[model samples]
Target: MGILEKISEIEKEIQRTQKNKATEYHLGLLKAKLARYRAQLLEGSKTSGPKGEGFDVMKSGDARVALVGFPSVGKSTLLSTLTSTTSECASYEFTTLTCIPGVIEHNGASIQLLDLPGIIEGAAAGKGRGRQVISVARTADIVVMMLDALKGDIQKELLTKELEAVGIRLNKKRPNIYFKEKKGGGISITATCILTKISERMINLILHEYKIFNADVVFRDDCGTEEFIDVVVGKRKYMPCLYVYNKIDQISIEEVDRIAWQPHCVVISCNMLLNLEHLKEMIWRYLHLITVYTKKPGKKPDFNDGLILRSNCTVEHACHAIHRTLVQNFKYAQVWGHSAKYNGQHVGLSHKLSHEDVLLVTKK
Candidate 1:
């Protein structure tokens, strides 16, 4: 049978199979096979052709955040409200036919926001150009899952599942698993801590399914079988996601409070313009972005134009951000901020920078 047919069959089997110690190995093998087939399917699509219109918008600004949700959930409205870009907003679903790019300027940083076409139920299965939309989302630094307040739970679950199916892990970190392939040595499994969810034998079986016989595996965390498979596939994108509940004005106060209390969630009313500023703040925090000001030898630091860099960024990152060739000079930088030991402390390229820090780089 074809890859899709095989995938469907395997999924059915996995669902029907009982989840007990007796069937653990069987389930593991099936999951590995399913992952392999899905990878093959995605690879085939890569060689298919162009990704089509509007989906290939150039990545710009300090970072990119994708606005993804069901149709008429106010993604377009959010984009328009936050940025100058005018996306076609409507009361009906599927108003956005393609990806529309906008820029949100906040805290001296420009964040590119993309209002993509609304995703349907069978998005992961390539229904309604879902694959294309998700493909663009993978390139983003963060994903903003815009959901209607009334149906926030349902939309959030469905969107999360769709994103997860395509290897987009939201609000998660990459599994702390060290995996390396070898040419001669047989499979070696080691763990820093006790592995409860997966065993060495099961690991070997999963590896053999992928035809990976000679590899070194180290488990740093007690991750599950699926996480191990993701490590093996090594094509997964683990990034932060913000669940944005829109149209909160229509919902009751109790509902809003409950949704707002959830982790990594932001409630807003694009029509009424409520809590939009908080949404911006949440986006900035989730992106882990920090601004650093540059100072001359004698002149004051230029606070008007600050360099936007990721949190825990080093002076070397600042150099690269200023200019690609700035690092070749090989010099130290003076800092005057939280990261600095003292005022105007001379720090090397490896010195981590803090938010709103002042930096003055010296040449060789």
Candidate 2:
């Protein structure tokens, strides 16, 4: 079974524990979400199944980083290079016919990296299984856009334009406003219009230009770039992504230097046996994971429920992630790192957690 299945098993075990009302409620919420996603997976409409599987599996809540790019762009090559899973890599197009998953290790933690089939031109229009690829792209927490360095800047620019032109804004906040004649009597849309602070005229002009004035939209500021457009104009999800320039060994040092200088771009060489370790490190950094450990009596230290947090996570959020009730009824936490000579330090909820910190959360 996958990580999600393992998590479900854990939750089921938690629910089976008699009289643990809180755990049961939490498990119920997780199950409801899982059921909704399973229904979506069985729907099998429009790029549904191929990419849809990722969404269904991911909604059960696992950290996912997706590999996406054009055909023959070495996405599969990179996946095999960085992880234990060996997917078929070819010299020609569409080698990855479906979503291929691999477990990659970084900082002593394993993260899920999905190698999705290539996204070609007219992907949104379902050309050459583009919709299928985009569907996988929609579900990822982080998207790694694998580019053929040999294809050069024109190809890069074209993809960037294509991603942004459809109003797939990245890292922007947009409100989810629902318009209603009565309760649940009209269409529902995710809001993609990010100019929430601007004037009504500006908003109207933007909507007219995008042709989204006729819909009820939900604003998802944290959604992916592609999903941003879908939420605003249609019901779609947006995912966050990083651009990975693959086949770096084929490019000259000077060319590599030029591409590396691109802001926030992570360039890596994937030549079957190249810097695979370094590539995995970069993936971890891109995912924003900081390793920590969970201690259990007489058992080996497990990273499971060790709080896989974003780099920006504070002690408060980490506390909540450990157990929602802890955050609600927080007292103080004792934290100790391997480097620390002290046994532990008592701190408030906002205290930022560090790598290898063993935390004991106390609640009143």
Candidate 3:
């Protein structure tokens, strides 16, 4: 049988098998095998994608958010409505054949939004341009999973599965596992917290299946078998996702209310421009951006256009963000804002910055 067939058989066997202490190791092994085969499939797709090596859209602005969904899901409309850039919008399917770029300027921060071609069923299996589109998603800081209000829940499930099949883990932090490969010693595993999910034996089995015989592992959090597997594979993309239900103007209030209740979801009508400001606010909130106004020596701070930084950012981060090589020069910075205890407090590169903070960097 082929690899795909073998994967199918293993999946069937796993499904038939019962879950308990007796079959846990077996299940883990099966999952490891499945992961290996999937990895192989992904490796094959690297060069075989519809757009060989996948088409590239230049990254711009402070951050990138990918709009992904089935065809005719209002992705193009949403893009044109939010930004000045216009993506070809049509009533038919597959209107967007490539990545369309737009920028959303909100609260003095510019965010790049990409409208990719619609994904169809089995898109993850190199069907259509799904894999290539997913490649863009992997690079994005956030994924806006646009959905048709008529049947969004089902679409959400399908889109989630497709993204997962290609190693995209949404709204999840990376596994708190540290690993080091040793020259000759066997695998060594340590955990800072109690591993309540799978045992160390199962971990070893999975690692061995991946041909990892000598390594050191430290789990800082309660990670599950899949997380451990991801660590072993080491290509998973963990990012935030916003489920946007569009075309709500065509749906009923009762239906709209249902989807709005879902976590990390927003209901909007791109055609009618309904709740778009709210959507923008949610996007900004999800991005967790901090505005930092710059102050040149002997000049006032520029409040109109401030530098956008991510939350928990510091003076060094601001320096690097403004200029890639600015951090190389040793320097001190002055800060005045919510982050500083007093006005014009002198702070070092390590000094953390808060929203609407004023920064004055002095170079070496």
Candidate 4:
């Protein structure tokens, strides 16, 4: 579906879900944000190309990785190589006027990549269009700092130090957050920080500088329920990014190897369009999304037509994905593959499917 449609649907669902609940200020803020997103979607559908006005917005959940660095750093050029996006690329600065999303496909699974405008030094100070791109970077799952390899190490160190000074941890653990809707009418979010390359020392430094720890404190208000605010936490427990050392053709192989020695960082020649497969493999392994097969009564098992689920996804989620009614009246499911002990075994709705599973559902 188009972004506008998705936003409209989410807006409708939010309204339906919140009908009986005492709406919070955050919920209202979410609505206003979504409305603005809907407007952007409408505008985007009616036009093409980045106009001179401001940065172009991307639909929520479209981008998994965001490319951020100084201007004329080959971000646009890399976008052209990875995805079908036709972003304007030139040697001059400010070529990318907006956040452009492109797909990077690996082993048939694709991840969305965002090519954001350059972020200069003192960007958070609101100089050099810094505020605009920083807002874009805040939403990104992975932030890639692309450097011009030919510019040498002195320039690279300067950019790295600037990001560090701004309280961005170069190495840290990144954890995933989960949001749960309670029966009582409010949403609850639970999360754990994964132990990662991002050091605790760095996280503490950023938290102190950004005042994230104070913002994250959970306390009880006059109400009976608990209240907790989200914080700008540390990186996820795991490294979810490939340090793209773009323009490898411009630098020596020894330099590339030296740069790769940086903890949790990898060197790649996006300019040479080299080692793209290796990068894709890294993503697949990181995400843990494996290929599974689905079987029809009279047909051979088809891997391409099968849905990709989490390594630990419940049968309930799969049933809902297949059809809504199946979940409401789901009785027993006959399965094959890893989830099934035997070739064809009957299991309950709570079954956790594995790779190469064939399931047949029987509803009550």
The model with the greater TM-score, 1 or 4, is 1
Q: Give one digit per residue, the lDDT tens place, for model 3 in 58-165.
A: 899988999999999999999999999998999999988988899999999889999989999888777898788888889888999999999999999999989987
Task: Estimate every model's Cα lDDT from 0 to 1.
Answer: 0.92, 0.60, 0.89, 0.58
Each prediction's TM-score versus the true structure: 0.96, 0.63, 0.92, 0.60
Ranking by TM-score: 1, 3, 2, 4
Best-matching candidate per lDDT: 1
Which one wins by lDDT: 3 or 4? 3
lDDT (10s digit) by residue, model 2, range 1-364 = 6434544565566467664434444443343333333333323455443434443344322367877778888888777777788999889887777788887766666678888877776554335765556555566777777788888466566655445423343434443544322243334444565543333333334344443446454544433322332333444334455666777789899998898888556677777465566666666776677765655434555656566677655678777676777788887776677523576677887777667677776678
**Ranked candidates (lDDT, high to low):** 1, 3, 2, 4
Model 4: per-residue Cα lDDT over 1-364, one tens digit each = 7554566576566676663235543354444444345345434433653443445555443236667778887888878887888789987888887778888875555667778888776554445765556545555555666776676355466655445423344444322323222335322222254333233333334333333343232212221110111223222122244455667787788887887777545466766677666755655555566545556555666667666665688778778767788788977887888778898798888988887688777778
The TM-score obtained by model 4 is: 0.60
lDDT of 1 at 219: 93
Q: Model 1: clashing residue pairs?
A: none
Which tens-of-lDDT digit does each residue in 9-69 have in candidate 1? 9989998999999999999999999889888887888888777688889999999999899
Q: What alpha-carbon RMSD in Å does predicted model 2 have with respect to the real structure?
A: 15.6
